[model samples]
Target: KTTDILVQAQICAALNRHVIDVTTPNVGLQDWSNSAEYYQQSPCNHYAKFWDQQGISVDQLAYGFPYDDVFEYSSSVHTPSPSRVVVSFGPYTDGGGNDNDEDITGMGGNLSVQFTDSPAGEGFANLIDNDAATKYLTFNSSAWVQFQANNAYSLSSYSITSANDAPQRDPLNWNLQGSNDGVNWTALDVRSGVDFPSRQQKQTFQVAANSAFTYFRFNLTNNSGSILQLAEIELFGEGSSSGFSQTIQAENYSSMSGVQLENGAGAEADQNVGYIDTNDWMAFNSINIPNSGNYTVSYRVASEGSGGELSLDVNGGANVLGYRTVPGTGGWYNWTTVSHTIYIEAGTYNFGIFAQTGGWNLDSWTISLASGASAQSAATAFNSENSMLEIAEISLSPNPAKSQLQIDFTAEHANLTLLNAHGRLMESTSNVPSGSLLSISHLKKGLYFLQVEIDGKVTVKHFIKE
Candidate 1:
């Protein structure tokens, strides 16, 4: 069985990996290290009671002492608490005699409690427990326990513990407010209810909108005669911004024509000349080129036409380069080698291959740097069928000549033909130029191919008529 292998030329670019080093400015490294170390060990529990104290008011306490001294105070107050402590304040007056009548109006009945030396005070442990004592104190009607507001905050939940042993007097009333600049205020929520003696109850409020407020306050309107206690208060909301990063991969193949790898599949070859139709080509993976430089492209070709040629253009775009042609060797399955070095910039470039004349087969095309600094010469040995052709030595003079042409061949008998751009035979000479010159100054100014046939082997050389 015989098979025709259509090899499409593949052009690609690649970049090597690079390493970069970054350095920081020299400064007081000691200070920077100390600050970082200190911050790492700082207590995050500090924010737990961030809103517990603000302005001149105290909202809540971690631990408190009871009004009655019947219970013994534990020496180990540093223990963790299952719940937070609360403090309630109201007016207490002493009786006294009225000046106009004999009635006692100004009695020494007014009483008040100060937050002093109790585990429930400002300097208590980071956390409190349920077994902790609840602190309650009497105050004048003009007196109020200040609760700190965390800017504008939303309350998720709150718990209140009352003294069951004490008798209740006035109903306990509370109101929530937000303040900007810690002065102007807006009401958020309010509630009034009878106090539970020596019992715990929880209240929760949901915020409508997320806002920025510096001050929040929980005002106590009326406190039941019995001292009040609060177990815990919690506020929740979104606080920080989120970030995202994305990566993009770009490829450019606009400079390519006849042969191209579309959609990252394989290589495609165009057999017909003129405008190339890319619909019949194979796609391949994209190449990544780092910087612009010079590269040598090589490919295998097998053609059966007496004078068929293929044109390959590499790095074709605003700045085009790498233009060359591979001539037909008149045998199928005969591999021919052609190469060209082109300077390309650092970018994705497109390459194209077109059949200048008749159909041809292409295979194993690769672009890489030449072995040495000089331009890479054409291949001298190619595999054809089961044998390799040791290319015969042939010479052409005045390669960029203005008019004359010369050639030297080793074969005793040979046939030579000068063909123009349209594949039309311009001139033919036989058994001559074995080592002599052929004059033809009348030839038009353009590109032409010199075909020399010796035995069954053919050699094609390109010349420019300046």
Candidate 2:
């Protein structure tokens, strides 16, 4: 927030019910840890402000309740009904309540502009990416900027901020337009001979849309000189900011053009391709949740070698939804799905997928309401594939096996069966052939279990399907 602030909360089961302990410098899983040298920066510096609202004195509310003190995090909301549900979502742009100044346009679509040659990072991409430190600049005195709304929206108003330096580069004349397509535009607002005397100074304008529009255009012409620039742009409307469903296709992500995209089956995935890149990311903008609760995110992915990790970042910020490790499937074509639950405030947000280390392939991802889901579903989300095994001695060749697998065992003829992460049978082979190589190039990437029945001895081995 504005000033440096962090607090830790501790509630003792043994302590009398009314006593609460508080401390400084946040220490939590998503926030800063006790060992972390860096401080945590969240949207709210004082989640414990609720206590102050309740008239609890500072000395009495020692250490501060912190987030965990009052808010409970879980995949399901049925445990305790949420008092307030998120209602509306605006465009995930600056001046928009959802993004909160974090740039995220690099993850996906929704932005297009005329110029990008002013500064290395200051271009059309940076304009909507959410960082106020970076700005959009164009060499041409006249340029056009556009924003696409994946969903319909009712207009309210918007604002623009000037670059922190050089006031002469600001737009002197501009026109705002609304349209269903970028080709055809209708003027909504226009300004002539405008000026921002102070750098980074923001000027807002109010407007009303007669009907829902999916496209917004900002035409800037006749700037102070031979260049046009802006630090940020924001839009607001009556649009519901949260509680909506969105599907992100792996091949459709917005990242550096270097990321490789390959063909895929578009059955569960929206796009007919998958993507792979290191440190590159894909983003989904204007994700609206109907209510305040935990959302179960399901990802369909595959990897060939030792898999890597994937982290979910909201609005290009450090707010990690969760992290999941990708398991190796039998081949690059083999695909399987994994899931995790994350808590999100009911509102509009730009959700992004960052490749922590890379070498992971994604097919698609989906987010669904988890309030009605079973508790078991939430628990299983945390368990990794091949983490549990009862029989350890049996040697399985090619641990992160690809294409084929070899199982060596010393026992009488036994029955062999392969199961998926969900404990569902995928492949079965009987009549033990010790050290035999089995063709398993058809399995998807994930955790699989192998069960063997020999004499009276039963052995179960959990293996990675990579």
TM-scores, each model vs. reference: 0.23, 0.34
- Badly placed stretches (over 4 Å) of model 2 are 1-108, 240-466
Q: Which candidate leads the pack in TM-score?
A: 2
Off by over 4 Å in 1: 1-132, 141-152, 163-171, 194-198, 205-210, 223-466
- Residue by residue across 258-277, what tens digits does model 1's lDDT show? 54321221232323122223
- After TM-score superposition, the amount by which residue 285's alpha carbon in candidate 1 deviates from its true location, in angstroms, is 57
Using alpha carbons, what is the TM-score of model 2? 0.34
Candidate 1, after superposition: displacement of residue 80 in Å?
Answer: 35
What lDDT score is found at residue 313 in candidate 2? 73
lDDT score, candidate 2, position 346: 54
